[model samples]
Target chain A: AQRVTQPEKLLSVFKGAPVELKCNYSYSGSPELFWYVQYSRQRLQLLLRHISRESIKGFTADLNKGETSFHLKKPFAQEEDSAMYYCALSLMDSSYKLIFGSGTRLLVRP
Target chain B: EAGVTQFPSHSVIEKGQTVTLRCDPISGHDNLYWYRRVMGKEIKFLLHFVKESKQDESGMPNNRFLAERTGGTYSTLKVQPAELEDSGVYFCASSLSKAGGSYYNEQFFGPGTRLTVL
Candidate 1:
């Protein structure tokens, strides 16, 4: 079975402060990781993927195979960044179905 | 290009009543997916469709849930006699390409329908 875990239910940070949302996964085979965010009153959107290694909205997450983790990080938090973030994982063979974490709500206070 | 769209932004129904949620994926996207987030739980995959065909449905919780995509234009998920445990948000997503290779195809999501069962 594949599983994704977002340890924190909520993370509060002041504007311009650095933030990190922790995520861990368990999969026997190769894993595909992704970060998705849902802003207030908006649909959930893809933030970034481990395969791309690209930054979105100043947020980046590296998939560490050694630790079985994929933690999302941002140097500066913006009020607009306040949203629900989910870390997702899927095995290479079953990439069509995404297994998601419980999600962490980031509150960026101005 | 229009993103994925789901009808009935919110629905409230008594237990034992049926509810059907609709989803219209982005134009030209062959892949459509169904996911649900139950109270205090992670967003979980319910199924996947390739055009009008069911691709994978291993995640479906039970037979109470049925999904269909006619003519590959739009899809509908019907829940018969929804239970209190079914109250949560249901999300639909779509992707353009097949799953494989180094390139990761992004799945665009709809606003999602918040379902409340009494």
Candidate 2:
């Protein structure tokens, strides 16, 4: 069974400070990881994916195969970055069926 | 293109009642998915539809939850005799095609319908 774990329930940081949301997964096969964000009154949208190796909204996540971790990070947090972040994992066998982690609520205080 | 859209942004029903949620996928999307997030829980996959056919429903909790995609367009999820545990936000997503390579896996999501069963 594929499972995603997000260790933090809430993370508070000051504006311009670095932010990192920890995520770990347990999967036997190769895993596809993603980060999704949901702002207040907005739909959950894709922020970044490990496969893409690209950053969105200044956020990036690196997938570590050895550690089985895919942590989302940002160099400097902005007030607009405040939102609920969910880490998800998709197995190679499953056709895009994502197993998500309990989200982490990020609060960037101005 | 218009993104995935869900109807009844919010629905409140008492236990034992039935509630139906609708979702309209992107015009040309051939793959659709339904997911839900219970209180303090992670979003979990409920099912997947490829056109009008159910591709995967292994994640469905029970037989009470029935999902259909008629004519390969919009989809509906009906929960009969909704229970207290059914209270959650249901999200719908659509992608171009399941076989269209990895890029096609980028799914656009709906705003979700918040269901509160009292």
Candidate 3:
């Protein structure tokens, strides 16, 4: 039962507000987590991976093995940050296939 | 370098009709993958190709779907007698294959082809 779950279908927030997009997973093996973003008219791009431990565009995610979560968080939301966010999981093995969550749409209002 | 590209950005075909989708991965990338996303569902992997050989195709749904990557270059996915459930956006991705590395090879995605089965 390997799966990724994004609880919020849509998260609306005003500019300068803190934003959090929840993501949880259920896996039996070592997990490699990633957050991908898709802006309007743009292709999907990797935002950050837990392994990198680096922030991208002021956003960050922390992998909690005990909670089985890798929630994406940003201190302040910007209009440009509005997009579809997907959380993906892959095994630490040789396989490259990704298991994606249903995704969440974040709308940052002015 | 050009990213992965998919042909026929949009396709509309009736049920029982056939449709072929093409993808050209980024040059020099040896790993190519196909994914599909139905309405309201998460994207699911359909297959993977390492050059001209299929590295894994456990996600392919059925026999009506066939994928081929000839000459270890461009690839094609053909759906014969497509059903309503086959309607979705098909995505192609590519990444450089690495040997024994901790750096996660990031996968670049194409714009994707939206297929409609009426």
lDDT of each: 0.92, 0.92, 0.94
Q: Write the per-residue lDDT of candidate 1 for residues A1-110, one digit (tens) a residue.
A: 78999999999999999999999999998889999999999999989999889998899999999999999999999999999999998656543678899999999999
**Model 1: how far residue A21 lies from native, Å:** 0.7
Model 3 lDDT, full chain set: 0.94
Model 2, span A1-110: residue lDDT tens: 78999999999999999999999999997788999999998889989989889989999999999999999999999999999999998755545778899999999999
The ten-residue window of minimal lDDT in model 3 chain B covers: B96-105
| Candidates sorted on TM-score, descending | 3, 2, 1
- RMSD for all candidates, in order, please: 1.3, 1.3, 0.9
Best by lDDT: 3
Clashing pairs in 1: none
Candidate 1 lDDT at A110 equals: 90
Per-prediction TM-score? 0.96, 0.96, 0.98
Q: Candidate 3 residues B1-118, lDDT tens each?
A: 7789999999999999999999999999898999999988999989999899999998999999999999999999999989999999999999989568555689999999999999
lDDT of 2: 0.92
Shift of residue A19 alpha carbon in model 1, Å: 0.6
Clashes of 2: 0
- Poorest stretch of ten by lDDT in candidate 2 chain B: B96-105
Residue pairs with backbone overlap in model 2: none
- lDDT minimum window of 10 residues, candidate 1 chain A: A89-98
